[model samples]
Target chain A: MYVILVYDIGQKRVGKMLKLCRRYLHWVQNSVFEGEITEVKLKELVYEAKRIMDEDQDSLILFKNRDAKWMDKQIIGQERSPTDQFL
Target chain B: MYVILVYDIGQKRVGKMLKLCRRYLHWVQNSVFEGEITEVKLKELVYEAKRIMDEDQDSLILFKNRDAKWMDKQIIGQERSPTDQFL
Candidate 1:
């Protein structure tokens, strides 16, 4: 699936979350990541993300589409940390 | 269309961006928002967002789908803001 993951983590744990997510998805900007991955890999990413997050304070939301083609993306202003390589 | 918007703004201008986005979309997490909107409204949002952003330093991305059903959303940990009203 193609997933767009947005995370809001406590300051202390955010670096770890960023590192973990970078291994599986493209970091498009602050607190946002997206890319295509298999089901198993998605599960693995979630498992690791959960371990890094504090359930009481942090939040991670994943928007999944069967494929990237199902959605349209637009960017205004700068394209920080571009993910065009994934395209 | 259903849109998921994420933004990275300079600290000085972020508050304004947040306030503006809140008027047109549901705040789902820090710097992340989503909701259903008409094409014209979406264009208006882009216009306003551009006015508040610095092209060299700020970035805003919009992921648009024909409808919300085309994507699946999963939340882990605390949901900083609930957007069930839009659903």
Candidate 2:
């Protein structure tokens, strides 16, 4: 499944959430992550998220798509160029 | 339909995109907006978005859900309490 995760958390907790997400997905933008993962991973991610969350001061939204093709994604600006070291 | 709009653009253009989205949806978090909008209004929003976008330096993504109930939203932390100026 393709999952889009967006989070609104306290400023102090930002780093922790970002690190947790980066462990499982690519960092697309500020507090927003999208990528493919299995149902099991999704559950694991959610579990970890719940553990870290304040439960009373944060919001986390996940939009799941059965397939990436079903979603139309548009990029308008210049993205960071891939590192030439890999090339 | 419930629409989720997310964007990544130049720092200089952030204000314009934020303003444009604020006109149609609630500002839920940084670079994220969500609300219910009609198909016609969606088109209008897209058209206006195209006009403001740099096309080569920004990215705008819209996720459309047929219904809000289909999506699971979780809030983990404290949200702003509604103010009652009258009360």
Candidate 3:
């Protein structure tokens, strides 16, 4: 199972999400705001991400198959972000 | 450059995006809510998508890259959506 989390949010806390993903597994990700994580690894990623995330609004975790050719982009922010190169 | 459009929307318009892409290029896609389109092809996708969108709210186009391993998921909607398979 693959996961694509569109956690509808602003720009301030992108770092928080990325760090959380890093804490768990090796992922090919994009967008600190909107994450393209797989479901097999999602439970761990979300658990960690939720730990750092403040209780403000609701976020959605969209799940898909890994076989699916799913991709995400960074539209609103600057280029060459620190979050670009994933571990 | 790669593009990931988080149009911050509900569930009614996912189909609108996939149809527009099929009109343009042969892409490997995921959610219609958040699109995983390449920057080279972004201009065509965004232009056509913007035409169908109502413009009621502010949407963002977050551009990252193709080299970047960005992915997206389908969190809120149901399973086996028509928007899953891209042409």
Candidate 4:
């Protein structure tokens, strides 16, 4: 099964996640990874990436279950953290 | 165009979003609201809901563009604020 790691990144650290993960694993063009990804491994990736996120900013990482019928299109939105207040 | 507000709620504040918006507008059962929701009005709904989120927690709100081909099925996942990582 393909594991899609969909991220709502903090914008500033977009490529940092890629740099850290790409050397050790193969990443799909759309930011997904297929094959076995243990919970332990995912934690490591997030932990390392955490350094890139500012306390004022954070990132969202969703490990999508590709085996399931998921929406294939890229969803879009932008509400600068503070800006999201208005919804 | 239908403005789809997809929220990654801060666990404690789900109903707050619905309660505030449902009164003035009609909401679809699957967490999507369709109507001419002006940005000005949406801000009011979000602003009111934020009072319920904890200082340690925040919410992610995406105003899904419904005209686009979006996956209509319910997407599921549970991640505590500091837990997601290894993938």
Q: What lDDT does candidate 3 reach at residue B17?
A: 57
Candidate 3: TM-score of chain A is 0.44
**Quality of candidate 1 docking, DockQ:** 0.89
Error of 3 at B20 (Å): 12
Can you tell me which runs of candidate 2 are displaced by over 4 Å?
A: A80-87, B9-15, B38-40, B50-57, B64-72, B78-87
lDDT at A49 for candidate 1? 91
| lDDT of candidate 2 over B1-87, digit per residue (tens) | 777788887788788888999888767667888788898998888888888888777777777766665555544454432221110
Query: Number of clashing pairs, model 1?
Result: 0
Worst 10 residues of 4 chain A by lDDT: A78-87
By lDDT: ranked, best first: 1, 2, 3, 4
Pairwise TM-score winner, candidates 1 and 4? 1
Error of 2 at B13 (Å): 4.4
For residue A24, model 4's alpha carbon misses the true position, in angstroms, by 24
Ranking of candidates on TM-score, top first: 1, 2, 3, 4
Local distance difference test values of all predictions, in order: 0.90, 0.71, 0.44, 0.42
Second chain alone, TM-score for each candidate: 0.95, 0.84, 0.44, 0.49
Order of all candidates by DockQ, from best down to worst? 1, 2, 3, 4
lDDT by residue for model 2 (A1-87), tens: 777788888888888899999888766666788788788998898899888888787877777766655555544454332211110
Please report the candidate that would top lDDT against the real structure: 1
User: Which residue ranges in model 3 land beyond 4 Å of their true spot?
Assistant: A9-13, A22-40, A55-58, A69-87, B1-4, B7-45, B48-87
* lDDT winner, 2 or 4: 2
Q: TM-score for each prediction?
A: 0.95, 0.71, 0.36, 0.33
Over 4 Å off in model 1, which ranges?
A85-87, B85-87
